[model samples]
Target: MTESADDAVLALPDRTLLILDDDRPFLTRLARAMERRGFEVTEADTVAAGLVAVDKTPPAFAVVDMRLEDGNGIEVIRRLKEKRPEARAIILTGYGNIATAVTAVKLGAVDYLAKPADADEVFAALMAESDDKAVPPENPMSADRVRWEHIQRVYELCDRNVSETARRLNMHRRTLQRILAKRAPR
Candidate 1:
């Protein structure tokens, strides 16, 4: 009895998901949570590792960080699309911006989500179809929250150098520090 190729393929379950993030703790926790949710999760801390994983076995779903210790996650999305055009990709970032979100969508990401996103949110983004109608946010971000997010983004871009961030923002270093010390506004 010879097994057909299609039969062999059907014998394997398809629940693979790839998660790439530079934050070790966050990556570990997210991977574990996804596993609990019944996905066969593969994780990478850098772009290179992620590319390798895509090459080996392109996942059915992917959650990629916008910034990595080595490179941006957009490259990973591009490569994944090359290998698996049907794969759903979501770009996750702590430094969210309209420009980057546009780029991510163009690179084949199904969604772009800001950081501190829980596993449930990530999963929802991954599972949502491209044609699904998006529900607009009930309340948009306040000016203070936008300012706080911009400051945080600049601080990360400066590699957490308070003085450099302040200089770039044209603000006093002490003032920047004080604002950074405060919790984000709603």
Candidate 2:
């Protein structure tokens, strides 16, 4: 009797991971942090490079950015899942949205996280075994803080142009400038 694909014993993958992001500083920091947490980290700065890395050897885990200069991170994640079906991946974005998050989960991503996520949170998400509800934060962001973050996000999206941000947000340019100058609310 010949052994089939189903009959073959599956080998557990090692703790190898790929981190793909366009932001050089964040990529370096995340790589160092993930290394400290015991993942053999491989870093790529573009979707093309990410694809090359995946083709070379598909990692057991990945953290891909939602948008990049070369292409969308979804392509990289798609290819990784194709090569390594058991791979667990996550999508990180500076701006979070429901549609993209839904797509990422459908493509085998374990979770989608907004930017500025700490190393501990990323680690926990990677290691979670069940699709259990996340514990709510005891001290969530205040309304003012949320508003400030929204403004900042819009500012960045508008290429940091104060006038453009103000116009898009339907606020006075001077008022937008004032908010930009102040420190973020806690």
**Each prediction's whole-model lDDT (CA):** 0.87, 0.84
Instruction: Name the TM-score of candidate 1.
Output: 0.72
Tens-digit lDDT string for candidate 2 (35-84)? 87668899999999999999999999899998999989999999999999
The residue-by-residue lDDT of candidate 1 on 113-144, one tens digit each, is: 88888887787777665788765644657799
Candidate 2: which stretches are off by over 4 Å?
1-13, 137-186
Question: Which candidate number maximizes lDDT?
Answer: 1
Summed backbone clashes in each candidate are 0, 0
Model 2 score (lDDT): 0.84
Cα RMSD to native, each candidate?
6.9, 7.2
| lDDT assessment of candidate 1 | 0.87
**Pairs of residues at least 3 apart in sequence or in different chains that clash in candidate 1:** none
Candidate 1, poorest ten consecutive residues by summed lDDT: 3-12
Q: C-alpha displacement of 92 in model 2, angstroms?
A: 0.7
